[model samples]
Target: MSTFTKPNHIGRKISRIRELRNMKQEALAQALGTNQQAVSILENSETIDEDKLIAIAKVLGVTVEAIKSFSEEGMINYFNTFNESDNNFNHYNTCTFNPLDKLVESFEENKKLYERLLKAEQDKIEYLEKLLKGK
Candidate 1:
């Protein structure tokens, strides 16, 4: 039997991570300064350049290692194992890190990104204003 089997395929891993993050391919493409068709091709690729992979990981809000080691089956298994009786759900799903802590951390990261985007836009406006003054 000859068949291709690559559980750690980075392209597929990126696609899954994007989906889990509730991001569309167009959004990912925009973040990468590319297009939806390019993103589609990327997902179909078996191998990707390291620098590009790092860029994708950044846009996906994950580490390069996280994308490299990602597995669809593993994620399914993790969620499957998380279901428990209603009374014991919280007890059974006790995590090494608090969920609230993760939420707060995500909020902080989003705030930082928002601030950076605002600053960039403000800088662009200032530059345009200077140009107008010159003209």
Candidate 2:
């Protein structure tokens, strides 16, 4: 006796599939010959035309039914049916600006701050040492 039901919402499912394929919104848009904003809107399931939906499905390598089955219950059932490893969502986790890249970028900024603080502390220690020597 299965208690699984179909999804009422489609946005989440579409988004998941897009992500699973590791396609960025911009890349998907390029494949569909559409804009990234439009792709974003479609992922959110705002209000896309039939042609757009068909194109999206084609680009995402999934059936229209898979995209349409995005309701909460449907998502739960889908996950239960599919074997979800930790890296299952890795494909869809593309970032416009990667966190590791950002961290590397800010490395110099952090280094400068640390150097300034270290110099200030050294100056304070030297000043205290001079006062003690005088006493």
Candidate 3:
């Protein structure tokens, strides 16, 4: 047997997600183009408008569903799962360039810049010598 139930305290869920993202109510209010007091009132309410919820979720860098289904224990469990080495997987990890190649590229760029500056200084010295000889 299975049961269907609706989640409660949607506003509190939004608040929890915001806090987890290291955001303050005032910051969220700024993102929403409202004010801190409005944010406080929103956090204290039971329900939030759908459009505003979407806006808040975007500002918090999360999906609306994430805020809707958020719970403290669930978040902790999710983080713990990542801490276990066995669960670590490189499913989508890709590197555009090898680290050694990147280092070589950076060194080459710096070498080119140094060469250009050295040539400039040499040219300036030659120009000054020519001016003194003419005088």
Note the clash tally of each candidate. 0, 1, 0
How does each model score on TM-score?
0.57, 0.45, 0.58
Q: Candidate 1 at residue 131, lDDT?
A: 100
**What lDDT does candidate 2 reach at residue 58?**
89
User: Per-residue lDDT of 54-134 in model 3, one digit per residue for the tens?
Assistant: 999899998989888888889899888887754346544666679999999999999999999999999999999999999
Over 1-135, each residue of candidate 2 has an lDDT whose tens digit, in order, gives: 989974444666677777878888899889988899977887777456677778789888877776765455666877776666536666677677888889987998899999999999999999999999999
- Candidate 2 whole-model C-alpha lDDT, 0 to 1: 0.77
Runs with alpha carbons beyond 4 Å of true place in candidate 2: 1-7, 70-135
Q: Kindly indicate the candidate among 2 and 3 with the higher lDDT.
A: 3
lDDT of 1 by residue, 5-123 (tens): 64556778888899999999999999999999999999988889999999999999889988988887888888877574555867777789888999999999999999999999999
Off by over 4 Å in 1: 1-7, 89-135
Error of 1 at 112 (Å): 47
In TM-score terms, which candidate is top?
3
Candidate 2 shows a clash count of: 1
Clashing pairs in 3: none
